[model samples]
Target chain A: MAIRKEKFTMIKVAAQNNIKADKIDEFIAIAKNLVAETRKYDAGCVRYELLQDVKNPQLLTMLEEWDDQEALNNHLLSQHFKDAMATFAGYLEKPGEINLYKTLA
Target chain B: MAIRKEKFTMIKVAAQNNIKADKIDEFIAIAKNLVAETRKYDAGCVRYELLQDVKNPQLLTMLEEWDDQEALNNHLLSQHFKDAMATFAGYLEKPGEINLYKTLA
Candidate 1:
């Protein structure tokens, strides 16, 4: 097989839940919208997805890939990112967690 | 409450497996080594972890955090990363995947 350069990189984020399970849809939508704007509209982002932890629906995880850290850095500084960050932070009842990794397996 | 600045950022990585089910230990160790060196030895990294998929033992996931994209970028260029990459790339039976995200929820 011909070798090709890897186009994207991964990161994971988890939020500490305070939003009632019944209202998670409301919360999830806001987060989902934020991501779509970042990944779909943002130039550097390659792919992004939101994954709910099956063991704990309250736990929300985001899976995303970017061209590289630079592409990611650019996304963070974009105007859309600033708008999303302003309101999104208020939805979290507790501070969230994020993890970063390079594919090595 | 005073707001504390968020320190680390998140990223995720996944690997497609070709290693036999029983041989995962050996393969995992190698993957683990790459992560440890990338996170602990690299000054910019905040935390790192390797997570296994419950449904598929053959699947592996990596969870990591960095001070930010800059720290992550620094880690990527550090000598340990280069060393790890040189050998790590050969072990993978198939290409690995990575994701990047900003904690918004």
Candidate 2:
């Protein structure tokens, strides 16, 4: 049996970052600002929100939904994204893991 | 600075599973039915959808949002959820990882 590819156009992103324990507050502050700007200005951004692990506060995940690949690509190049990345660099315990997905159900 | 805890009522869940290559189709079929049932009948299930990793076909993640912890807990005890789990047991490569989260932004 083959995996069906219908309705796979929308892109969902899960960007997981391990922030330094002391920097959680700072990271979230910047992330909240980025979320606001992306939602307000980015086209085809269906959802963009940050989530903190219930058991581990240092583990932060950005749950995002984009209309398509083009919208996601645009978000990567947007000024707000770059700005947040710059600040996020110093706050992260290690490099973040970004995984892109397509809706299957 | 302290991490503010306002607006943390919503519960988000990310359940990641690795399906056997041969069982991917079977797993997805069951999952799609599970998604439909959960969305249509499960109360307080804001979002319950399956996502396939763009890079790894075997990796399937269920991205879910619930109204609160009580709703999420109720979902665990749901008959549909148990029924799906029984079929999912043999198809999985390993035990699935389920993480609960709170929206931070």
Candidate 3:
């Protein structure tokens, strides 16, 4: 079998969200909606998933995979993202920690 | 088109590693070796990618996808993991932050 080489870089962003215990259910609902909307409307999105922590259910993570930086940039400016952020502001205990990463292999 | 539903739970673990500036190259080499070995040997590993931070080059993230918790547990006990951890001890500025996540959708 021949080795397949990936020419284009794929970007991954993991955002950690710590929500209040009381707002867990509400947060999940909103997040699910946001995921659905993003996957449906955002053409650049390869994978958009909302993950909940096993130890602390209140802790949530958003794992996103995009085609490139341009795609991710477009997502940042999209109306859906803006709307999601506006609604998420109240449920967050502190600012979410978002980090960007690129795959080496 | 019919929507495809994933029956089995796929577990994801994101580990944040902050390496000393001097050890970045060495760390990446070791991490690459580990990833290659894991992919070759481990049966349960679905995806294993080493990601670099765009803003902070010293910050590294390991995004892992496994079939289940049991598979993840086995990996934790694998020789490759132990060897990698032992080698990683000297390069890290701080303890790595490893968090487990479950996808909701």
Candidate 4:
């Protein structure tokens, strides 16, 4: 394995969403598309993946790792993200909880 | 980057904890040691990271990725894991919320 020489700080995001029981499938479909687009086109995206809780299928979390704050801010303002948010408005049980974190280890 | 040839299913775990405000630093100290030990000694441990919430300092999450169920189960049963849990008992505001997930994209 090869390691990159430059040092960079990563911005980790965990966006937790709880969907209505009946709208879980619809939520996943929209989420999967959003993940695909984010990973394909978003610059400085290291990891952008959707995860469904095994015990509670209605619970979803977008686990994201970006190179820095600039990358994360750009992603939030992107068209696909806005579109996904609009589509998700009706399916959410409540507003999503987004948390930003700095890795400690 | 060198991609491995073998195919394996990963078990993603998000273990969220809310520490007592005064115990946050102590909790992080214990957690950092656990993360280091898990990464250095545990087999099939792909990622063992401790993340502190940027907005809420008392909120911490352990983001883990294991190779499969057996690996996850093994980690849960390990002495280091058991020891960490015992040490964390008094520092926590409440029980940790553990969620297992599979990547969707």
Q: Of the candidates shown, which would achieve the greatest lDDT relative to the real structure?
A: 2
lDDT of 4 by residue, B1-105 (tens): 998787778989989999999999899999999998999888999999999988899889999999998899999899999999998999989887888998888
- With a 3 Å backbone cut-off (N, CA, C), the pairs that clash in candidate 4 are none
Q: What share of the true interface contacts does each candidate keep?
A: 0.00, 0.98, 0.90, 1.00
Poorly placed runs, candidate 4 (over 4 Å): A1-7, B1-7
> Candidate 1, residues A66-92: lDDT per residue as tens digits?
666777678778887687567666666
lDDT tens readout by residue for model 4, A16-38: 89999999989999999999999
lDDT (tens digit, per residue) of candidate 2 on B46-88: 9999999999999999999999998898988999999999988
- Alpha-carbon error at A7 in model 4, in Å? 7.3
Per-residue lDDT of A3-105 in model 2, one digit per residue for the tens?
8877647899999999999999999999999999999999999999999999999999999999999999999999999999998999999887788999988
DockQ of each model vs. true complex: 0.04, 0.76, 0.73, 0.79
Task: Give the best candidate by TM-score.
Answer: 3
What is the overall TM-score of model 4 with all chains considered together? 0.90
Candidate 1 lDDT by residue in tens digits, B1-105: 999987655543222344456657776787687776775577656666666543455656656666667777787788866775676555655666454544543
State the lDDT of candidate 3 residue by residue for B40-67, as single tens digits: 9987999998999999998988899999
Worst 10 residues of 2 chain A by lDDT: A3-12
Which ten-residue region of model 2 chain B has the weakest summed lDDT? B3-12
Query: What TM-score would candidate 3 get against the native?
Result: 0.91
Error of 4 at B12 (Å): 0.4
Chain A TM-score for each of the predictions: 0.70, 0.91, 0.89, 0.91
